[model samples]
Target chain A: MLCLIAWVVFGILGLFSVKYRVLAKESFDCVFRRITFKKCNSNLDERIKSKLTGNLMKFSPKMARGVYRHYEFLSWIFVALFVVSLVLGAQGAYNLAMYDNCAGPNADPDQCIFTPDYDVVDCDDPLCDDGHCEECGDDCDCEECS
Target chain B: MMNVEKIRKDFPIFEKKKFIYFDNACMPLRPKVVIDKINEYYTEYPACAGRSYHDFGTRLTDEVANARDLVKKFIGAKKAKEIIFTKNATESINLVANSFKFNSVLTSDREHNSNLLPWQKFDHDVVKSKKDFSFDLESFSDKVKNFDIVSMVHTSNLEGYSLPVKEIIKIAHEQGAKVLLDGAQSVPHKEINVRKLDVDFLAFSGHKMLGPNGVGVLYGKEELLDGMKPFILGGETVSDSTYDSYKLEELPHKFEAGLQNYPGILGLGSAAKYLMKIGRNNIEKHENMLKSKIDIEGVEKIGHVGESGIFNFNIPGKGAHEVAMMLSASKNIMIRSGAHCMHSWFNSRNLEGSARASFYLYNTLEEIDTFVEELEKIKKL
Candidate 1:
């Protein structure tokens, strides 16, 4: 597990040193601004009497600064959100994997985090307390047997 | 008094949608102060903190130091050096979990994965978390003496039922067990007085408390922090080094191993300052007011609006993942569904699962009404 973390950390460190900037794809011409082309993965439209949408942007030679920036801002926002969500996902999963123990002396061997599948309480205990294992009787107690 | 509309204007997200972003229980949205703070760091003072001697480095160091001081005042930590910035609440817990040595750590199921897993991973025995999803007093009384440390979540990430930290800390003190509170879910929704709580350690993430992500806090009691091991080591964390042996830097410096996220740290300080300026009491009152308005049309939709945030709940019978996909497909409204990272706590119970819609101070009552109203359509699925 430590090996995996070290590998990931190494990978991230390598990424930081690499000097590169990536950009998104865009239409080849200004006329294409009114349209975004999506290749339909489907063979037929299922019913083809459809006129394609030319979702045109109104020509605003003079628009409010904030309004004009909002579209550009949104495009960047989408990019930022996408990247951040990706980064945060990695950080979260890493934290979970790194902190992979709840198997101490105070822990019920049954409730150890690594064993995410384990039933918290014995099914046959007297109380059979649904959530709280402490409320259970000695039914799941294999400690003495061990 | 903090005006909702005034605060709302600073967060452009409110202008974008129905805007009932109540899941501050998970992460708080960033404000202009935090956003500007981060932008300033990147644009003006982009430098590695504590790792260089140049002017840019010194400027970064001063900003981070000032941010740390702000953290000290925010949490009422005895000293600024006790504050260690981490990625999130989970990372903070992992840092605290791995840093300290104790025979065993006592924790409850009420804790988020951040608090539970790290302590759990220390190869320590985890006592059964209390019933009713609240801290069991008897459990603490019976168990603290048997363990070397105690960890707790200040509140349940799900229900927002608060634990008595002051009382829990007192009990742990009596038993010589160190207490650490997972303050991530609780802090942004409410103010924290770490000194008054008297917990040996407290872990919190900034995103959940009106700050940016990639920044969190570990506030340790001065003496315990002095004794605990550092989270990561290298670079600025070291005072002097040789191939054979190296000396560690002092307090917080020794703990922050690499080029820590200076921008996030600054954002975190600003977030705390913003929350403080607004006052904790008002924030709590505002959130609870929204939460109190959660309504049900019938038994069917009740399953849809399970409990908290618009996107932070699991729909029963329907696979959480499927509902999440559907919600995103039909509407641009974003949400998280399914067993959050605390799947173990949920798996422990016989109950199936629920949908959540956690509330925050910035959310308007009108938004809540709109969400509850729109959620009525969700049951149709």
Candidate 2:
């Protein structure tokens, strides 16, 4: 699970650079295979885990052994946190679009909230004068706004 | 203020397992932040310290120095120079037992081998612990005048019983004997002000706490360290080395002796800061509260739970190893069993070892309930 999340994090990083794109593609393929009941490249997972935890051997051999033993369990946690972060970011965006606030219902009107378009606008301001938000203009593309 | 749920969130291990982690006495799980700090070293500055004149090297040196200062503060040392980083507590104890010239060394029977075995090199005697698992302080005080150094564990690893270190140190000092505290079990669980404790030397490992492994600290008084010879000698430990003789470096470097675990040291600094910010009193309180929730009467028990969050118990008609294995296999509950590195102490008593459930700040009462529930099944098994 940790390997999968690490691959995802690496993949997101890979999106920014052409150098890591091939590695990310191969890693994603492995992840997809494992999840979809195909003959996944287990070696790819091992490679990613070693890449992540190999330096730990110098740090402490005992700890390195533990990391290898628990890599599957750790990956699940990493994936869960990644998912949680995605949900939180999405919820924050949702609240901003629907309620014109990131703190959801009881948001302080004086506080500036971030919108989906990366614009920070005060909650007290009239966000949508008509059917569109003033801060995001026509590009205020969000779940509630769309 | 001590929210177990919120605290558990900081430790990623909770989300990774269905088990209640009661093996904290061996190694507490690291928080995500501590892991990030270690990763920061690898990602940002993976350079060697005290060797290269490069920007990364210089920065790494400063970071290591900062960690030293933080550790000094964590243990309440009078100066940062007093803290010496080693591989682990075993190395730290060996450093003192080897370097410090003493006619005879004194130690308790209940010390972890890290503390107990090091005394083999020198003339040493073991003071026994009472049947209640507490140290026989009277025996220690009686023998204090005989030894030049009285080295003892501040806390017992097997029983989790705390020794009367303050009182023992006083008696040892009065007898002109230097005291070294094996603080591996004590430092992570409670606040220890070395100056207040007035111990001559204190040794502990970072992994026992919520820090990375491969880094341990031996804190001695500046004067005591200055007087003692360096255990390991050569490179980075000398200011100048002639063909014939070498001028040793200052207090800590003289002891460090080689290229140290820079990343581990930095992570340890972060761990110390994290624990301090949470306040040791509060961590102790949380562990105490969790201890109160454990129902040990239903399970076959050996000794009462100590103030520190450790319960050592035996199951009737079951080997400790079998009980530990069954617990892990059946319910996924993790614990430590057997002698716990105090083999001499256990052997002397002519008894088989017991299963140990040691808790940390991240443990919850609900988890304790799960542990008890599983132990009940293991008993039936």
Candidate 3:
């Protein structure tokens, strides 16, 4: 399952460095075997797990033990998190394209980076002059203003 | 006792990097003298050893001869001519396997792939190890009479347990069988005298003994080497040639074919000299002392932590490679993992593999402490 994340991370890193390319290929093989219901003969998962746990052992033995013991579970959790993020990102992109806001229609524009900055105007207010709200000083174009 | 600190100074790797190197069984770190010797060959006299008449060639030929003589002396061979240079111990064993006439061959079950693979072509049988993983001498004694040649590893790389070669050779000889000892692991760690052992042949690599790679020695009794034909033939192997037939050179030359690894050979000679200066007995003692300090609980040890420098073990429920990698990642402690080319032994036992940490002369007690500390932390995992 760690190979799932490794495949994506190392795949991108592989494009820039030769060293990561070898690891990327190994992780790719691991992920491929995993999805095909075969064992990962490449041992990429074990290598990553050990390397991570080993480094952790230097600072905290208890933490290292926990990590080593639950490496597979942790890998699954990370993979799940990655999948969730991917799905959310895709949904956000869809909402931004359809309703002009990543959080969907009637949501705050501040919630989405792609949402264009615009002034909030109340066309029915008395403060609205020339069909433009007061808050929309220079860059506002309400229906009445148009 | 060897001054570990002073000895560490000889190897330039120590100066360049800080890591506890425990993979001596795979290959020991090269010392500055060996490196300088190799560099000297490339810088001073980089020419064909035997074929050329120029000064560079003549000098190289002398250096190559000197290296052979050093190797012969190192192994206590009767004559320098008995020493034949090859790429490594594997090639040396292959040369013997190809050239030596034998109806049947016998080997120990704990042979490295190098010693085991070559004899697969012949009528080969393996002597099973004892319950404690020691050499089964009684089993070997019973099997010797049925075989023409007894090929065995002198010192096991898996655990560093040296087979009783002196006794094994005597038994093999009594049964009218010749012996070929794979000294790849033994020759580097301890002193081996072929004449004293009365062994017919011995093969070992130079890289394992603080030398450069791509050079190895095959020491055969002169009479046996004389009876056998050359395994490989080319430029330097022949004295004279005809349109119809060719006459092969004598002894070592016939066995060593083509242009040789001159720099590696010279470096190996320097390595031999370096080992001699340090003393093999000192190395063996220092390693034993270091091995004695390894006291970790809750982990299963592979072999008896005996007099040798190797310590093989596995943390329960943890993969051998995982433990080894963790140790490296935690403290930069280098060790060998997996079956160590002895897959037959591990497979027969139904074991995945064992992590092996082998010590050498330069290895200190402090390093052993760090290794133990790391193992204890890993054992919890």
Candidate 4:
């Protein structure tokens, strides 16, 4: 389960750096073995677990013990969070493409980064400049007055 | 008493790397002297031995012969011709396996893959170890009569326990069986005299004993070696050859096939000299003292933590590799994990593997404390 997440993370990092490529390949092998219902021969997950636990042991033994004991449960939680984020990201991408708003058509455009800012002024006012009045129509909801 | 601190100075790796190295059973760190000797061969005389008459070649040939003589003295062999250099202990064993005339062969259940794999083609029998993981002499005595040769590991790399080879050899000899002891683990740590042991054949590697890799020694009795055929036939192996008829070289040269590893041989000779200067008995005592200091609770020991330098164990609920990796991560403590190349023994005992911390003369009490302290933290986890 950790290998799946590691593969995605390392696979991306592997494109930029040469160091992570071997680890990326190892994690991919682990994930492939797991999917095929075979044990991971690479022991990449064990290396990661031991390294993490060992680093944690230096600062807090109790916390390290807890993490070591509940590693499987924590892996499941991490996998769940990763899957949820991936789904949410896909949904946001789809919304931005379909409705031109990552927050959806019913949601506020201010919440979406893709939403362009609009400059508007009331043309009914007497103080309205000529440049502003020309761009502003009867309803006056213009993006650029000039 | 061995001056371990002073001894540590001889190995150059300590100056560069800051780590507690406890993987000596697999390969001991080479001293500067051994390294220099290897470098000397390349810088001074980088030529084929025995074939050339130039100054470089003459010097190399002499050096190679000197290395063989040193190995012969190291193992207490009667003649230098008895010493045959091979790639490693595995090749040495395979050489004997291929050349020796034997209908059946017997080995202990805890044989390493090197000792076990070569005999798989022959009619092989295994004498099982006792429940306590000790070599079973009674069972071996019973099985000795049925086999033509009795091959066994002199000291187990798995747990560092030595078999009663003196007794085992006597029993096998009485049954008219030849004995070949794999001394890879034993020869490095303790003093082994082939003549005193009266063993027919002995095989050991150079890298495991502070020597360079790609060189190992096989010591066989002169009479026995004379009877066996050459394991490999090549340029150096033949003294004269016709189109259809060829006369083989004598003794050691007959077995050494191609252009030999001259640098490795010189390094191994230097290693032998270094060990002799330090004294093997002092080394054994130092290792015993170091092993005695290791005391960690709440762990399942693989075998009895005997007087040998190796300490193999498994922290409860943790894999062997996990414990080893944790120790490495915590303090850069190097150790060995897995079956230690004795998979058949582990499989028979229903164990995955063990974490092994093998000490040598360079290892100290402080390193043992660090190892124990890290193991304590791991046990808690």
Interface RMSD (Å), every candidate = 14.5, 14.2, 0.6, 0.8
Tens-place lDDT digits, model 4, residues B1-381: 888889999999999999999999999899999999998988988999999999999999999999999998888999999999999999999999999999999999989999999999999999988888888999999989999999999999987899999999999999999999999999998998999999999999999999999999999999999998986899899999999988999988999988999999999999998998898888988888888898877878887457787888888899999988888888899999999998998898899999999989899999999999989999888
Q: Which stretches of candidate 3 lie over 4 Å from their true place?
A: A36-38, A95-110, A116-146
Error of 4 at B64 (Å): 0.9
For each of the candidates, what fraction of the native contacts does it recover? 0.00, 0.00, 0.97, 0.80
Q: If the candidates were sorted by their TM-score against the true structure, best first, what order would they fall in?
A: 3, 4, 2, 1
Q: What is the C-alpha lDDT of each candidate?
A: 0.64, 0.80, 0.91, 0.90
TM-score of 3: 0.92
Model 2 agreement with the true structure over A1-146: per-residue lDDT tens digits: 44466567678889898767776777778778878878665456655555444345435546655765687887788788889998988988778878777768587744534633355433344674544666566554432532
For model 2, residues B75-141, the per-residue Cα lDDT tens digits are 8999999999998889999999888888899988887888888898778898976777677888888
Residue A37: error of model 2 in Å?
Answer: 48
Please tell me which predicted candidate would have the highest DockQ against the true structure: 3
Best by lDDT: 3
Which 10 successive residues of model 2 chain B have the least lDDT summed? Answer: B296-305
Give the DockQ-based CAPRI class for model 1.
Answer: incorrect
Q: Residue B26 deviation, candidate 1, in Å? A: 2.8
Per-residue lDDT for A13-81 in model 3, tens only?
999999989999999999999999999999888899999999999899999989988888998999999
**TM-score, candidate number 1:** 0.67
- Candidate 3 lDDT by residue in tens digits, B1-381: 688889998888898888999999999999999999999998999999988889999999999999999998899999999999999999999999999999899999899999999999999999998888888899999999999999999999988899999999999999999999999999988988899999999999999999889999999999999999987888878999998788999988999898899999999999999998888988988888899899988988896446888999888888899989998999999999999999988998899899999999999989999999998888767
Error of 1 at A60 (Å): 36
Candidate 3 lDDT score at position B81: 97
